[model samples]
Target: MNRLTLVHLTFLSVGKPPAAVEFSPGLTVIYGASDTGKSYIEESVDYMLGASELKSIPEDEGYSSILLGLRVDDGRTLTLCRALGSDTIEVFSGDLRDVPTQPAEATLKYRHHPKSKSNISRYLLNVMGIDGRRILQNSRGDVVPLNFRDLARLAIVNDTRMADKRSPVLGSWMPQNETKEKSVFKLLLSGQEEPVRPTAPSNLQKQVGKGKIDLIDQLLDETRERLSVEANQTQLRDQLGRLQATLANATAAAGQVAAERSAVVRRRRELEAADADTQQRASEVQQLLSRFDLLRQQYESDLARLQMVGEAGTILGYFQTGTCVFCGAEPQHQHPGHRLGESTQLAAAVAAETRKTTELHHDLISMIEDLESQAASLHEDHARHTEQLEGNDQELQTLDQRLEPLNTDTAELLETRSRLERELALHAQIDQLEDLKASLSAAPPAPPVAKADGIPAADIADFEQVMSQTLEAWQVPGDNRVTYDPTTAELAVDGRPRKSRGRGMRSVIHAAFAVSLARRNQARGFIHPGFVVLDSPVLTYRRPEDNKEEDELLAYDVVKNFYSDLLDNSAGQVIVIENGTPPKSVRDRAAVYAFSVDGSTRQGFFPPLDSSW
Candidate 1:
């Protein structure tokens, strides 16, 4: 187990002398004569721990405040200080002074003032170790806002007042079980009360049962719907069969129609081919006739021109003086030779023209004759083409007539089948719906179970076992005086009768309980805030002050045994501030640390010097 030394401590009441001091392990005793500020040392520890309200010092006492310096086991130092004017508690490290809260450097450096941040509280109460704060709170009051659940989980605690306070053994577990009444004490500090559960009988289960039956019904209905679908399957197949039969008949009729149409088309095509041939011949004959007409017209014009021009013989015989067309006989020198030459030439030209014209006439006559014969043949072909075209037209009309009824029948049959299929599908769906309705009418029920308790058995063992070891270390022996009661939720202790037990016995029992609680704290083995600060206990020295030997010795024994218990718990600190420091016989066997408050101050007022302002 590790220990924490009070590096420094200072006490100040408002407008009074402040006290400053330091601490070490084993024992730290502040020896202050009458009017000395010895109690300031104890008060300083309290202020640092969590005594929130300011304690005022008298006018003569310099300052009314407190300051403390703690050196933790891991070498981290913390400074806790409070002054008269300060509205808040402050902490720091080294030269860094007047800190808002504990420094968060390390676990060793953790120094919590009364008004610490919530996270720091959680760290202390939930994570650091077992929490003493909640248990402390049970004895204390509403000092801060915190999570009590987390606090209780961290540690359990006992204070110097344990001996004076009543035991928690009776009715402690009453609040623990879900069985009975809850306790206010448990609620305030720990937020842990009696477990609770609904007392009402459930009606929702019946509704759920009915709902499940309905769901099953729905499922059955769906199955019946499936069966309906199966039933319709045969009808649909039969309808399909009928449709197939109708389709087969229609297909046969259509096939016959197609065959007849094909035959008609073939005959029509043959007729069309004949018509085309006749039309082509007629066109050729018409073209020949047109050419013959042009050629005859040219020949007639050429013959007319030939008739207008007389021959050379007519010119010689009918010369009659004008004469000499060959040579202007009378008016000019008429050359008979020239005339004869001209006549001969003219005669030859006339004969040539006459021959060409005669050949053209013969060609025209032959063409006209050929045109007449071809026209006669073309007229016959045209008559045949007209007859064939009329026949093809009638055949095409007949084919159209033959296929129309088959197309209509196919359309009507297909439409009727589609309608029947839609009706069957609707009927099948309705049948399924009816089955679903039946299943909803009949439902079933369910079974029951129980809940278990969940308090951790491991924690109970640790809390109980650790306290036992701590008690033994404190040298406080007993015959199974204390026992844990989960039902009542406390550790019950049976003490010897007050008069018969004597002061020694009572002190031993309570001191054992306190030490046990301190040791049981996991944080005490590692990091701790401070020593266990006990209030004044003077039950042993109740005899006359004048009886120096027996009374003095007995009083000495009380503090001596108390101090011895503290020394045994050397892993941490313990402060038992009692009235009247004890004498030699009890002191010889133990170690003691002494501190002096040199300042002159009155009782109930802060001291001057030896502390701080």
Candidate 2:
């Protein structure tokens, strides 16, 4: 089994001699008065082992760096030096003071990360025979890589930690950490190491998947709404075919309507042209009738003039022998102005003029009759054309009314078909996404591993036995049938819960738990750091407040035997920092360091706090 033992812890000052605490393989104790920096020793050890930051103390003011010396199982010494207020630690081959100008190996970081070679957890965990091990981090059964800081909670116990009621394996009070903490303890007990494989999907991937599912669901809902019906792909395809056939029939019908509309348009245009021609012909016929009437009137006027002249000649010829009636004179003796021409010549002239007038009148009458007949024929033709134009106009109006509804219906059908096709396409996309989601959900799960659920029952039983034996050796009060509760990752003393006991008993039990773990690992070849630093483990014995007399006596006896039992824990290193001194039996067999208020003999872990300030 690989083991890591802390040889010494040294704190170096800027311009003064360094203060150091030494340790041995079996047991080392630093017991002294209060405020003597005993608790600081445990804190410093934890800080060097990758703690986030060291606690501030007045005695630590002048310290420039902290150095921790470790002896690996190979018996080689390695020293790590951390400068004050720095995140990097320098590693040396042997003991260190201040900071090394040139480190023997690469500098290590104070934090842990998977890809970092300088991380302190890797360096410390490697020496402890537990490297590349994983621990469950969350309920998803996802495992995070192992590091020494995770195990530090079990290996280092400060004053508060000793009084804490929670399990030593647990680092915080968060409930999420309960399972993981128990698993870590189980891993230490089992001593099996396994490299972590990051099989769990990343947070981004999970989030994206959820987003995709949501989007697909939303799209599916919208598509169904657009379709106004819920149907499978096959049903949708059938519907599409039906719609296509309907559209095809509708289109053919619309084409016939369009042809009828074109014919109506052409007929209407022809009627308009014919109506215009009819109007022009009617106007020409009316003009011809007006002109003929005027010529007939002129011929009637001429005939009247000729008839008057013929009458005057006839009267003159008849009244040749008679006296004039109006002038009382004979016609032969009348004035030349009033006298008519020779009777014979005048009569002939009148007869000829009358004949000419009569002939002209007849000719005019005949021409007028002919013109009237022609006008009548033209009028008949105009009337017929006018009637035909009106009928054509009525037909055109009717056709326009019929085509309007068909055009509207065709447009509506086309739009509806287009919209349905688009909705079908959207449905196809939604179906694809649903299928993908199903396949992903059916994916095989990761194989079950130890610690994925919790620690094994048999391993817990073995751990409980070791703890019970340790407490029995210490002669602890109450039943020695102690058991490590895997659920709480703590111990149950005499069937009672560990935290239910008093602070005095709790401190003793917590100490026993740490010591037992180190011993158990050393004996069983389990993975451990081979060292445990416990601060004020026996504080309850020295200062038992409000405790019964029997309980107080029990505490005293427990503290005495506790040290003796620890001395026998071979192959394990135990460092106990306390305010109370130990029993002589254990003191004689261990290395003991004492700190006092007086500066003459010992100045505590550092120079005098007053001098340092």
CA lDDT, every model vs. true structure: 0.49, 0.73
Q: Of the candidates shown, which would achieve the greatest lDDT relative to the real structure?
A: 2
The backbone clash count of each candidate, in order, is 28, 0
Per-model TM-score on C-alpha atoms? 0.41, 0.61
Candidate 1 per-residue lDDT, tens place, 1-613, comes to 2334555565544544444444544444433232334444455455444444445444224554456666655566666555544544455665232333555343321234345443233333333333333221211111222342222211122223333333322212233322221122233222333333322224685577567667766665565544323436667768877997997899799888889878878887777787677678778877877887887888778766665554644577345455566455663565545555666666676678878988988977887788788778777877876777687678768877877988888888887677666657656565565555544343222222112212345545554565556544444446434545554344544434322344444444454544454455424342333344443333332221232334432334445555665565553555444334544432453332222322313332234245444
Task: Please state the error at residue 368 of candidate 2 in Å.
Answer: 84
State which candidate has the highest TM-score: 2
After best superposition, candidate 1 residue 495: deviation in angstroms?
8.2
On a 0 to 1 TM-score scale, where does candidate 1 land against the true structure? Answer: 0.41
**Model 2 Cα RMSD, 1 decimal:** 13.9
